[model samples]
Target: MALQHGVTHLVLSAFGCGAYRNPPQHVAQLFKQVLMQEYDGKFSQVIFAIYNDANAMRRGDGGNVEPFEKEFGIKASVFKEQ
Candidate 1:
């Protein structure tokens, strides 16, 4: 249905949640399966935005962007802490 409707550009966000920590590998794999494999060339770009609330089940968390970039063969706009 997405392909039929000509849907392009997918956004995968908020992956830094409690679902990880126990097993983090699954998070990245799921993103690839849903966004990259499903859409393939249908979308010009796919943005993986990772953000988590401080008071959530998991706190003091930072997301890994490089692995996602390499896995998807894309570059992301990220900044480093001072």
Candidate 2:
């Protein structure tokens, strides 16, 4: 849907959601998978603003930001500023 419309950027603004409320970590992966499948190769760039949600960011111990680049094959950058 979004991809079909040529959405270059996708934000998982799952704000005020259940999974975002609690998780064992995999929950976040599911979300990412869904997004990727929906917009795979459709967008030139995809950014995931998981905020401090370790699970959403796939952080095993703390948080791993590298997976975004390795798995998705897309350049992942974490931005924090005004």
Could you say which candidate leads in TM-score? Answer: 1
- Residues 2-81, candidate 1: write the lDDT tens digits: 56777676676646544554323456677778665666677777677754333332433333554555666767776544
**Model 2 segments beyond 4 Å from truth?**
13-20, 53-82
Which pairs clash in the backbone of model 1? Answer: none
**Clash number for model 1?**
0
TM-score of each: 0.51, 0.45
Model 2 TM-score relative to the real fold: 0.45
Clashing pairs in 2: none
